[model samples]
Target: MDNNNQTLATNELATLPLGHNWYQKVASNFEIIQSYLNKLDTDEPEANNLKNKFDNMSDKLNIYETNIQAIVNILSDYDVPIAIVDGKVVEIKEGD
Candidate 1:
């Protein structure tokens, strides 16, 4: 888009009311910023480094989510109540 159109779109986005769906608004804004960054010259070394960092962060997030799910599954296997204390998962005993 031309500079005029880009400015108009940005102005419209700025005018949006941040209320109940504020998270969706912020996510869309991030998408717009990512699109702009993706349009940059890929041959630039700094851009490559930034892309790598983003990739690494994405991978780490995935790993963290997977581990959390695994912990949830393991905890769900037992019928007793469990609690996390001092970074450890312990089963709750009756009348304790």
Candidate 2:
């Protein structure tokens, strides 16, 4: 998408009322980001500067994905209602 059409989570993701759905969306984004980062790890030199950037970004992303997975686990454990709108989490009805 063009820069103007990009999904700005700080705006749309935050203002919306999605719950577990957001977790799934975030998980998807994290996957895409991780894949690119992995490619960079192999394609680029192992110099300290490049390594540091990849390490920091990848580590933080892993933490974020872990958190998202935790929410997914919770929702699954309870069989909560889940609605993913436009590939993003838009609703989650608990215990339903």
Candidate 3:
């Protein structure tokens, strides 16, 4: 994935679901959500309602956070997801 890191466009931010699928393999969960919507038949109002809410999840959910004086970097091309910060990577390490 590192090879493609140079190619990940910064113009737009990639989004994960509300929570459960935040860190799933290759956006499989996200694809699942989209696949359902793609098949939505407007004839079915109930399906449309469900699709509507799911579509708005990105904005409704806490997708991004900001802390004072922080360097924000986006993770990509991964099965799962995370925001590495506080001068540490792969979780917090006590000391050297």
TM-score top scorer: 1
Which pairs of residues have clashing backbones in candidate 2? 21-89
Q: Clash pairs of candidate 1? A: none
**All candidates: CA RMSD (Å):** 14.4, 24.2, 25.1
Model 2: runs farther than 4 Å from truth? 1-47, 83-96
Q: How much RMSD separates candidate 2 from the native structure?
A: 24.2
lDDT of 2: 0.65
Q: Which parts of model 3 are misplaced by more than 4 Å? A: 1-43, 65-91, 94-96
TM-score of every model?
A: 0.40, 0.35, 0.25
Error of 1 at 80 (Å): 5.4
Clash pairs for candidate 3:
24-79
State in Å the error of residue 91, model 1.
Answer: 14
Worst 10 residues of 3 by lDDT: 1-10
Tens digit per residue, CA lDDT, model 2, 10-84? 445676565547776666566666666777687766677778999999999989877766776687677666544
Order of all candidates by TM-score, from best down to worst?
A: 1, 2, 3
Candidate 2: 10-residue stretch with minimal lDDT: 1-10
lDDT of 3: 0.45
